[model samples]
Target: MQSRGRYHRTVLLVLVRTVWIAVCAAVLVVSGIAWSTVSTISNGVERSFAIPEDAPRSSSGRNILIMGLTTRLDLHGEPLPDDVLRRMQAGESDRGGYNANTLILLHIPASGPAIAMSVPRDNLVPLSSGGEGKIKEAYGRAKVAEEERLQAAGQHDKRTLERAGREAGRRAQVQTVATFLNQPIDHLVEISLIGFFHIAEGLGGVDVCLKNATKDPLSGADFPAGRQHLDAGQSLSFVRQRHGLPNGDLDRTKRQQAFLSAVARRLKGADVSAMQAMIDMAKQDVVLDSRFDLADFARNVPTEVRFETLPVEGGARVDGLDVNKVDPEKVRKKVTELAKEPPPPPSNDGIPCID
Candidate 1:
């Protein structure tokens, strides 16, 4: 996603989700003076996909699902160039196989606190049908099965098949997560890995702090423990590094949240033109369903938007794969508490920086 590199690892597809909302808020702030920029981003806001017509919506708010996928396929379902593929690390895996590496459900209410609930990638959950599997695999499996079914039914165009297949996969993913959490998923935003890198670059870089020096070849993360600015590649590495951290992916989740807060700080001070450029660059990487207007919705959004992990019980093995386990009741309890929370504290910023 950061221009100057050989394309070789898709894991760097660190799609920082919270920034999208923050940037929307920023753009809205600059809309009066930056009409041209606002107009440009608004033009690309065309509805490109469908959500359930009968999807449940709360009178108080809506639940938006944001998914970070592992595949490098573009919106239309075609594979990207090898160099792009390699940089995104999509080349590490076969095409057409997409995993929801990051699954976050953001609850925006008309009143009270907003919740950014994160569902662990390796959580064990029931598939859309029956039986259990790593929740992340739901999309990939459904996509593959759908593609096969469509192919047999005589749909032969590669692009057409891929598109249809991905849609099935996305629906299954949304339904599965919604059912598991007992929440209605009202909308979605999908980000490609390459898009993630460019997005960070456009926004400048996120400020991050580490508790200790760390390095990881798998994710290509190397940093000294302290406060430092992270460019696109480094930002990707910071949130993408899982192996070296004490809590593994759980830690990376924090990195993601911290990055979002950093984004909020960055956007808060950016000039209109800078913010506009960031939005323009980001538009190239993000895919949305139903063209939800963040600026319009931002009006009713709770002043307190905070991120929290879905309460997890512990780790458990499902079908031989390690997974996070959660009690449904506990999750509901947390959601309830989140809904009643007061204005979010400034500490909404991520992991503490070690001086």
Candidate 2:
């Protein structure tokens, strides 16, 4: 009887040892899976862009140009209005020339909420020509120059127009705008109304609060006073409406900033399902400049970043059109102060190209 009891005890001890081994193996498997998941995400983000080997590493600081283009093509093959299409085809609109709807310069310091300053399309600046014109006209002038060059080269009308459009799109517009910003722009990202709307919808929606009831017939936006959740279309109209606002473009600029802030806030709190939706939306809606690495940048966006508009008094009529302009000297001084870095002594340094 004693021998049988001892044998039973030994078997129980063996069973416990076997269970311990199985638990350790299960833990190892789970740990391996977790490590693999993290590594895969990191690699996917890093490989999204072909960054230059010699590109300056971000010094805990970043500066980006956020341009809102005025194009009307939808990501999912929807067509724009016939008149809008005609304007684009005729090179009279949607070409990023005299009709650039929105221009914003965003500066992200090594630490802080990003500062965005709008350059009134009407601010007069020295053009490549000795004469001066509205800031909005600079790109148009460049487009005209490219067209002239193509004509001089004896290109056919259609070919000349195409080449001119490409050249105009690739020129130094961003850099010129950067000069107006009074600092070097480290990166640039352009988004259209359609793209913005798609992104907002993909994230479910964004909340916007207005102090008073507002309506804009042209933009098709109507909002009652108080907090409300805006869908994709409403959000677009909210940011794009200029008329009826007390301050016009200035007020619109503030609204744009607010919208972007809300979007960023939503993204920060997004769950896995929301992130997947965003990724899918980007695959369809985004057409980035070749230099942008969206995945990497998306993953690295700082949570503590703040958002503010550039200092500007208001809007005024320039050259028969209402436009916004930045005081060059004032902008320079403000940027220097905000950067907390002394401005370099005045020199006639030429502007850099947007590579």
Candidate 3:
């Protein structure tokens, strides 16, 4: 017969294991939502996407590009409803175009820490087809180019044409970022405003930390120093606000990272209800490029994902706009160094006080 102490310890162990399993299940629920459904086209254009066989990969490295688009329009370039616009708290009106406001290149090394490096939207770079402009504008330009090319080819199917244009846009955006960083990209995950809102709502609320009292009138973000929970509206504000941030766009980039950190943690334990809410919301707002297999990626998730910003000298005046000046080679070297660094100490329940 087992001793009383041993029996109690065994019972405690079982309870702990049960709770851990439940949490893992909850976290995976949101991840289970497929990206293929995230972008739907009624016009029925069946296209397949995959990385080239000779594309770079290593036994220890994986690079993925995760971008956030700035637009109030659906994938078809149509505007969202007033009610959703209000809930999203997106600062600007829907002008019916797209620009990548957030561009993060994530490096998940097979045997080391995962790094999420941010490339500011204002990073001025040469487009693949030639000419210099803010990197973010590539999406809109590519979409227009694809549409015109298809039209000239006598393919007048509007739905089919529009989806093709967006796919081309995705390809362009990924290439631009990858080339800028001098890195090879294997996958792309782009999330829209509505999907993000639903995701925040689905998770109940995401928790974020502030280092100092902050209020950005533009993004409409107001928060006190320390940790706090944010609803969908406020969470959007938290990541989008840049006007009052100390380093302007760079600080906003950091905020985006902190928010994602919390989201990464929340995703691990988000209940079925929360996951379903995001799934429902995503039906109209998320796009996972055809090459990525979400199920496989989720199952082989890294032990940790850390966020950082690419090295930059600072902002400079260019074409009457403040743009971040970055050395592509230097940035690439920095990331190569990052791959070998150890992961930071275990974060709080989520990342803490990321001010």
Candidate lDDT (C-alpha), each: 0.66, 0.50, 0.65
Query: Can you write out model 3's per-residue Cα lDDT over 1-355, one digit (the tens) per residue?
Result: 3343333322222211111111221132222322233222211222225345466653457777776888777766677878878887884455426788888777767755567778888888887646877888888798889899999999999888878887777778877877787788876666666656666777787888788998877777989988889998998888788897778888888777676666656755555455455445544565654555433554454555566677887788998988878787888788777766734745455456865
- For model 1, the stretches where C-alpha displacement exceeds 4 angstroms are 1-19, 22-50, 81-96, 271-276, 302-304, 342-351
Which candidate leads in TM-score?
1
Give per-residue lDDT, candidate 2, residue 92: 28
Error of 3 at 109 (Å): 1.9
What's the lDDT for candidate 3?
Answer: 0.65
| Tens digit per residue, CA lDDT, model 1, 55-117 | 776565788888877766666666676765455432443552588888888887766656777
Clashing pairs in 2: 113-306, 114-306, 120-324
What does candidate 2 score on TM? 0.65
Task: Provide the lowest-lDDT 10-residue window in model 3.
Answer: 16-25
On lDDT, the stronger of 2 and 3 is 3
lDDT of 2: 0.50
Q: Can you tell me which runs of candidate 2 are displaced by over 4 Å? A: 1-60, 74-98, 111-113, 127-133, 140-148, 151-167, 268-277, 280-300, 341-355
Write down the TM-score of every candidate.
Answer: 0.83, 0.65, 0.80
